[model samples]
Target: MTALSNRALNRALLGRQFLLARTDHTPLEAIGRLVALQAQEPNWPYVGLWSRIHGFTHSQLTTLLQDRKVVRSGLLRSTQHLAAADDFRRLRPLLQPVLDRTARSAYFARNSAGLDTASLVATGLELLAGAMTPRKELARRLAERHPGRDGRILAGEVELRAPLVHSPATGTWGSWGTRSAVSVTPAETWLGRPMAPVTAKDLIRRYLAAFGPAGTMDVQAWSGLTRPGSHR
Candidate 1:
């Protein structure tokens, strides 16, 4: 079969990732094309956009979040990320199990010993309903629900179970360091729409569009998703 050599494949990857050359795509359009951006802290995603867009500005992303067009949330690999608001509705549901797995791991499991799963999630949802809440405050409230438990750990677990987004204030272009007062809201309520059904095929198509001619392992690795009938 005819095939792209390694060099061609590398070029394709770079071009798809918007690294080969800067495009005039707006940050919003660029974000949709790229699917998601790493936002471990408040500022890294701005750097990602700055490198890829011509005349990229910090205000562009901040406006997007302020307008509810983009959101910062726990995404792939159970880590914080920035995704377009429309895309986040789908992406979070698709990766919900990944977040769940992280909570089920030994670290979280041990930290949350004796915490009843249903009560914990229900209480969190109830508390987060109808209002945006500071992360620390959410933890404090969850701690109140289960007096002996560490509020921070319980809040973290609630995050894994519920789709939450940090407020635009926290996501704004500020210091290069992590923002200290992050606030969160339920994704559905904040976006005013429920999550889209998980369609691994469509998500994979997005993956292949950005990084294609890739092997199953490549898709699995990049997305933190695995499928049956694949090589181990």
Candidate 2:
């Protein structure tokens, strides 16, 4: 087989990601095509969309959030990402193992040590079940339940262990202005649907469609999960 040159690879990626040319796709459609947008910062997705989407406006993306058509959640690479609702439903479960692993990092381990993780997750869920709650509030409630434990750490662990998404309003463009709190709710509750089951193979195929011509290491880099088989 002929080897692809660097320019070829770069153009292919740009084309696949819609960076080669401005696209007419709506904000939701663009997000769906890309699978997910890197969104550690709440405003990054809007800037990302603006660069790829023709005539894109901040409100367009915000509207999708308001309508629950798109969600901001811990996903690929176990970081916050903006994913369309259906993609989030399908993708989050496939990435759960990675997210769980991230929750076990030294930072969380040292802070939440000696606490029952299952009980903590349950308590966190209960607190978030009624409504989207601020992270600090969840942490406070958990601290109240387990006095002297770091509520912030417990809350952080719950966030990592549980499939949760930031409240849409928190992710809306300009929503963070003058606001110190960020709200979150269970992904299932926000989506009104359970996480769809998917296998590693299925995830790889989807990853390829959005970021393919990629090697196994590339997929691993994007997903933060190792695949069992060899890659071409």
Q: Give me the candidate number with maximum lDDT.
A: 2
Candidate 1 C-alpha lDDT tens digits along 1-232:
8778999999999999899999999999999888888887778899899999999988889899999999998887787889999999987888887788888988678767887887888898899875889878889998887787788888888888889998887776774443556788898899999888548877888888878768888877776766712312
TM-score of each: 0.93, 0.93
Q: After superposition, how far is residue 194 of candidate 2 from its true place, in Å?
A: 0.9
TM-score quality measure for candidate 1: 0.93
lDDT of 1: 0.84
Q: Residue 179 in model 2: shift from native, Å?
A: 6.9
- Candidate 2 residue-wise lDDT at 37: 92
